[model samples]
Target: MKKILIQQLFITTLMLGLSHNALAEDKKPATDSTPRQSTMIILDGSNSMWGQLQGINKIVTARESLKTLLENAHGNINFGLLTYGNKKKSCNDFTLVSKPEDYDKKKMLRNIRKMNPRGRSPIADALKQAAKNLPAENAHILLVSDGEESCGGDPCAVAKELRQSNPGLQIDVIGFRDEKEAQLECIAENGNGAFVVADNTERLKTLLDGVQAKARTIVNVTGTPVDGNLPGSIEVSIKSTHTGGTPSRANFSIYRPDGSNIASFTSRIQVKEYLEPGEYRVKAQWKGQSYTNKVIVQSGKTSTLRFDASQSGMLRLSSLNSNKEAVKANYSVYLANGDFISRHVHQDNVDLRIPADEYRIKADFDGTIQEKNISIEPNVDNNHVFRFE
Candidate 1:
């Protein structure tokens, strides 16, 4: 009887741990392939960019990186440049440096090399003008900054509004130094992009390359009630032939009959919910990211939904030496009960695919033993890397 009780408890914990993800079985969103996307580069010409790093000025690095990016972004990839250095102090000081144009390698390199970093960081104004500046309806903004707004502009507010105005618009931000990461992250999310840190000027090239790669993804969503009734939750199945890398956010636009924006959120690798929907548009936003698809929302039967990166956080572990190397030995992971969650023999990584929760992780490998309690959250990655002899 004691053993039965323990088994029941383990089953209960496992189910409860994954309750959040179970909602995907209820409602499913349609999937559709998307078209090619364009990009807009928002250059932060603040004096900080001109500062020296590793005996190399960042602006110079930015220029070189721009040349490399422009040359390799493929012919379909167009470009645009918005510089804060070229702005004025008056209310009408906002200007458009270069509208969205063909990726002219020569012109882009020249502009970057000629960039004279000056003035305060006017992020808000630059974003506002970016919207007015870019020609394509579906485009992304690459915000390169090292500090907060010196010109007292609310960049996040502007980016959010711009997203509402432009359905597929996104903003990918890279901070050069340890400034306000949280604030800038919001700006990135508002634009439906990702925020990253550039520890050095050299990373500018890699960062932009990643952003460019992420921009090509395009996912389309269409929604309709199930059996003429709306369910408590919606299950969206994502089927795509992706080559490599990950798409940041699932673009969603709740619209009225007249096709005006109502509510929008970037999906976090989970089936989205809270639907009393009429008509909606869900598009994937990333720089070079392209997909040919439609997001169909069905209201009736629960359908399975898949996430590129499961908001569900989990970890795979293996016993390792002090050198942080996996050990070639017998190992097994178990729940509080004796039920085997996973086991290994000389394996480097073990699958710990689970929903967000805290766990007492134990390991026995190579005749050495260790145990650890681990936690996995929904939106953020869990912090747990273990090694054992």
Candidate 2:
């Protein structure tokens, strides 16, 4: 009887062990296998976006196109909306309307509809802000602007800066009624992105479709081998393809294949250096902006990289009394559609770096209010005097 009990106990223990294993297997956690990608839509809210394109305002066309784009962007992708010139007139007029999260078409459309173009086009500042808002290391940016940088900011320089910080950042640009193709193209190139022109709503939709397609597609890069250099030594060259001019000076930070900082140097315009045959990360800074990229220096061959640079402008606001003399007063600026830009309190003069745009100025001198309209041109010092009678 004791022998029989011992055999039964062993069988029971074995069954319990098998049952525990089955329970543990059933409780295994599930994880998503899909890769996550992020895209920030930097929409232009400057007054220029209100201009007509094919019988409809640019803003309306953009909204419709974006609606379609978002509808198609449904997947494991995060979408965020950022707008410049929609809220205020200051050069720092960028607002993160929506934070990047799981794709939400309705929320994005609602936010886009709420935007009213009233301020200056601070394209560079917007780009800089996008860099900070996006948490993804390899984020994609889609900038749709009806005009060039209206605020005194260099979009190309900022794009280069973002590239330096995040080598995988891509910035695609859509120019709506923008005449400066080279400027927008330079921005795209600096961000290692694409540029497209949209003259009408149909074209805008087409361009957006292309952007979506590119976003969904994965790119496979294959490097070619070269000859002539010594073993473990490779030749590298840096080039500038900016529109305005070459950067005065550029600083480079090199990283080894093991992700350790190896060396750094400051150079001008184009730079060439001999490096070891391996994977490397390079960060270049120029004109207050940073750009980062990767290079696989193969033994015996040379690799050339390119950068871009652009220009900006400034605006000065001064106050005058009926006597044509400078006087201290409070000022309120607005876009043509009566949207508020900014307000300066009790100041005789205010200097601001702004993109080119038409503005309405309202001055309050000791409780008396006066209004005037002014237009600012790019690449020059725009001085506006508010005469309070």
lDDT of each: 0.55, 0.67
lDDT of 1: 0.55
lDDT string, candidate 1, 195-255, tens digits: 5555443334434544444333222224432124332223332333342434344544333
Cα-based RMSD of the predictions, in order?
25.6, 23.3
Task: Please give the distance, in angstroms, between residue 300's alpha carbon in candidate 1 and its true position after superposition.
Answer: 32
Error of 2 at 229 (Å): 42
The window of 10 residues in a row where model 1 has the poorest summed lDDT is: 285-294
lDDT of 2 by residue, 1-389 (tens): 99999999999999999999999987663245444457889999999888887778989877876777788663535788889898888888778877676445677889888889999988998888777778655488988887888777899899998988898787877776556666776687677664556664443454455444433332211333222132122222233445335444566666775657654544544343435456777666554444455677644344566543333235577777788899998877665655444577988787754334677778788788877887756567877777776
Candidate 2 error regions (>4 Å)? 1-33, 200-206, 218-389
Which stretches in model 1 have alpha-carbon errors above 4 Å? Answer: 1-36, 86-95, 200-207, 211-389
Candidate 2 positional error at 246, Å: 14
TM-score of each: 0.49, 0.48
